[model samples]
Target chain A: MNAKLLEIEGLSAGYGAVPVLRGIALHVAAGEIVTLVGSNGAGKTTLLRAISRTLASRGRIRFDGRDLGALSPEAVFALGLVQVPEGRQLFARMSVEENLQMGAYLRRDAAGIARSFERVYRLFPVLFERRRQKAGSLSGGEQQMCAMGRALMAAPRLLVVDEMSLGLAPVVVDQLLGVLAEIRGEGVTILLVEQDVFAAFSVADRGYVLETGRIVREGKVSELAADPEVRRAYLGVAEAG
Target chain B: MLFAQILVNGVLLGGLYGLMALGMALVWGVLNIVNLAHGALIMLGGYAVYFLFTGAGIDPFAALPMAMTGMFCFGYLLQRLLLNLIVRSALLNTLLISFGLDVVLTYVAQWAFTADFRAINPSYAGANITLAGITVPLARLAAFAVALLLAGLLWLLLNRTRLGRAIRATAQNLVAARLYGVEPRQLYAVTFGIGAALAGAAGGLYGVVAQITPYVGTSLTAKSFVIAIIGGLDNPLSVVLGGLVIGIAESAASLYLGPTYADVISFGLLVLILVARPARSLRMA
Candidate 1:
């Protein structure tokens, strides 16, 4: 098995005094696509925020064997743990190219940035086409692509994507899934937080079922898909009556 | 011919007015800090330039960079140490804090430099150039030229540089900025520093064109607020255009209704704009 890239232990986080995530322990191995599937309001975003250090949390989040507890969000990003946040928070007024440029903001490596730009363009040709257009002007799917493309521009080791399929057409979601596979093939481990369980299982090698901030199930995607409880709750397969 | 001359004067003065608003607009847009202390920073810049010219024997124009540098450091430390602590607080809190800062700065200036009006009188202070039928004071023209030049430079800094990209990104989405490895506190400090430097430049030029007193800050701050509202906060050139609008309006008011009505006209225009375009002004804010 690959070594763990991101390991969390007994993590608790929330907004103000309201606790959202409680004692959640999970890990993602290097170069693996791990999906955390949960319904709406299941604290998926909260967990992601905790990892990004945007939300205050009490827990140990170790990335690549280093403790993330003391580090700032930017420091976490500098360590190659980048997040494509929920709701596609693109700099609305900036052009697509400028948004991409912001992704590589910390890198002083001009040649590498140029290469990343090429790679992002190659991955999302539509983004290259609309490079000069404002990010706010893009379609919902395009915005998601731009967000992902922006994260990819950072050359992240572990890309934590929150709801890639949100507000996207099924065809676009499928296309994004294919791209996620391609990204994983490029040796970038992924932690995909998704509301669409089936779509996530399609791309993810491993799956964790989180409900109300706790991980209730974890197994191979195939195993989880075949599980009777998961089928009943998530896949909407009615029991034989 | 008289009207044309008045228009020329207004245009010349408008450039400086726009320069004064540039810093306020920038800090407002980026840090979401209305920066009531902005005028005080400008006032301090005027004093710095005044002392540099008088005490160090440097030309007032030559002293601009030094004043700007000093103000930049002051702004950097101000934002880094003090403003950062309460940046995420309520807007009213920030407003009160900044207003208090403005008062403190004004009192300090009064204590240190006295309330006496001091104007920078270089050898060419009275020099004027007649173009066709209009007379343009050399110092005002130089101030106008410098203002436009600085605005252009600010535009370049924001559009052409990597640091500029980070700043714009932070202004749009702080989370996205942090996710892309931007330390927002540092970025905020730098942005505030740049804003302060612009104010410093404008202050120095204002001293060249007009009198400087400790009490000059309040009206200048009000004027800057009005201009920033008229000009959308995002674009540098637009802010200057806003300044021009105010400058022309004030000059025309003084011409037709006598000099004392200048403030009345400018504030009246502000009221009209706010009443007419409430949505745009709110969005700009």
Candidate 2:
């Protein structure tokens, strides 16, 4: 197995006095595609926020073996733990090219940035076609693609994508899943959080089931897919006779 | 002939007015802070230029960059140490804090500068150029040209540079900006510093064209608000256009009615614009 890239232990986070995530422990190994599958309001977003340091949390979050508790969100990003947030928060007024430029904001290497632009254009030709168009004017699927392309421009060692399949059609989700596989093949570890368990499981190597602020189950994707409880709760399969 | 001269005077003054609003519009756009202390920053800029001219033997126009640099540092510290604390608070809270800052700055200026009315009067202060039966004050023309140049520079900064892209991104989505490794606090300080520098430049020009006292900030701040509203907060050049609208209106009002009607005309225009398109004004704000 590859070395662990991100490890979280006993992580608890919440808004104000209300707890959203409690004692959530998960780890993603380098070059692995891991999925955190949960229904809406199961604290999936809260967990992602905790890892990104956008939400205040208490526990040990070690990314690439460095403690993340004391670091700011930008500092976490500098360490190559980038997050493509929920809702595909593109700079709506900016052009597609400018949005991608923002993704490479921290980098000073002009040649590397040029290469990233080429790679993003290769991955999503639609983005290239609409490079000068305003980001807000893009279709929903295209916006999601732009968001992913923007994150990829960062050249992140580990990407944390939140709710990639939300509001997307089946075909679009399939295409995005194919890209996720391609990204993993390039050795960038992915922690994909999704409510669409089937779509997530198709791309992920390992899976974790979260319910009401706690990790209920975790294992290889095949094991979780075959489990009766996961099937019943998430996959919408009725109990076997 | 009188009409043409008044129009020329109005247009010249309008450019400076637009420069005055540029900083406020920028700060409002990015930080979402109305910055009641903005005019005081302008006042401080006037004083800096005044002292540099009188004490250090620097020309008023030449002292502009020096004043702008000083104001930039002042604004950077103001945002980094004080304003950043209350930045995440409610809009009303920011308004109140900035209002308090304005009062403090005004009082401090009154104490230090002795409430004396001072104007930057170089040897060419009264020089004028006549064209097509219209006489234009050389200083005012120079001030207007500088205003347009600065606005163009600001436009280039926002649209052409990497730092500009980061700022625009941060203004649109703070969370996304953080994801791309932008430290909002540092960016905020830089933006505020730029705003202050612009205000300083405007202030120095104002001292040359008009008068400067500790009490000048209030009316200047009010004028800036009107221009910023009319211009929209998105573009620097647009703010200058907004200033021109006010300048022409005021000059015409003073010519047709009386000098006292200038403020009345500007504020009245603001009210009419706000009432006519409440939705647009609300969105801009």
Candidate 3:
């Protein structure tokens, strides 16, 4: 059986005419965790958005052996390729439970949804504890967890996370990374975008370094960490790790 | 005892008023468009029901479903063809277009129905019940009951059903709502149609209780806006309670502060609510 889960070739996209992601090419096998590390405005979020069909792009995006670029965001989600967009855009006025219920927005099987809620609760006990609270009332860390939990409610085969570590303390980031690692163990393909080089490398099996909307280097995390130039450019260190 | 009667009267009338705001709330909450034409749509519903009952000899109560169905179709087409064209445009532009639609609709209504008052006077319109020294107009009571019933139905649609959930999701985030396999055009059309239908039903009830004329559109639209804001945008029934609040306030105003200030009070409340909670409404907008 074919194992390639997602393949992007010559993907070019941007807001109107100002192109951001230029001729980007990448692939992810089933159940592999890949991280894209880039500085601000490097088009990492745009790439994820393009895959989710939230942005207009000219490229071939094949997800789980099907063209994804043609599909709308909802259609893409139906295919089990969901994106947890940046900024944790939870419906603030909605109760935490209502917000979570939205995660199963496209689903019909109530029984399975009930079971998924149980799983989500098990994953993040804080969300379960404050199920009735307003989502906006939750702190930033909790909101991020809620965002992840909401995305998981879709039963995604591939999860695209944008800046999960942003505006989070080290301890909170560590906790989130741990949960992500656990999610990875469940054989879910992950495309992680982050500015935190350390966290991205720590959890990702392989890493793609993006500089100003272009891929500069792609390799195994260990191998990339050992390269002097990659270390200097991406990690802000000249010495080999 | 007189005060008690006044309060009961206010509560009953408030139920229908809440119903009026319910549609506006639903459309505004989910569609993210403060439908300036909402009251006009309600007025149209009233006229539709009025003509159906008076011309066709259909029982006024029975004619409701037919009127609702007609309004729903009209609203659906309006949204799908006209409103959808500028839905993606600037908010100010959408508001102006809806306002224009309101003007056209008001003028057309005046031409068809003529410049006169209309009330859907079923035989049962005058029947009343006395409970604990308070006289309850049977029509008003029935209208209030139906109003609550409709609100209950809406609550069920939005919470218990998948389609309802998608509607809600769409309201919160249009993209996310679409991600749930909902067609934006179809979904939006359906939502607006439902809103119109609710307005039609409310207008039918309201016509029996109060005077409705071509000019009624401006005030009813303002009242709906006031109730919707007072009720907040999250739940449908809270808006009914909001209506009740306004209803009681108006009742008290009529008895004590005089009737002319009723509109003033609600509009004042609207201004206060909008100004005080600009942050709250800002996020949703």
Best candidate (score: TM-score): 1
Ranking by DockQ: 1, 2, 3
TM-score of chain A of 2: 0.97
Q: In order, how many clashes per candidate? A: 0, 0, 1
**In model 1, how large is the Cα lDDT of residue A4?**
100
Let me know the DockQ for model 2: 0.84
Interface RMSD, in order shown? 0.8, 0.8, 2.4
TM-score, cand. 2 = 0.95
Candidate 3 lDDT tens digits, A1-241:
2398999999999997788998898888888889999889888988887888878899799998899867777778889997777888786756677777888877779898998799889889999999989888999999999999988888889999989999999999999988888887876789899999888898988888887778888999999888888778777886735
- TM-score evaluated only on chain B, model 2: 0.97
Q: Which RMSD does model 2 reach against the true structure?
A: 2.0
lDDT of 1 by residue, B1-285 (tens): 999988999999999999999999999998898989889999999999999988988999999999999999999999999899777568888899899999999999999999999999999999999999799999999999999999999999998999998888888898788778888899899999999999999999999999999989999999999899988888999999999999999999998999999989888988898999988775742
How good is chain A of candidate 1, measured by TM-score?
Answer: 0.97
Candidate models: Cα lDDT each: 0.92, 0.92, 0.84
lDDT of 1 by residue, A46-86 (tens): 89888988788998999999999998887888999988888
Candidate 3: list runs displaced more than 4 Å.
Answer: A238-241, B179-182, B272-285
Q: What are the per-residue Cα lDDT tens digits for candidate 2 across B1-285?
A: 988888898999999999999999999989999989889989999999999999999999999999999999999999999999887568999899999999999999999998999999999999998898799999999999999999999999999999888888888888788778888899999999999999999999999999999989888999999999998888898899999999999999998999999999999999999999877665642
Residue B104 accuracy (lDDT) in model 1: 98
Candidate 1 wrongly placed segments (more than 4 Å): A10-19, A55-60
What CAPRI grade goes to candidate 3?
Answer: acceptable
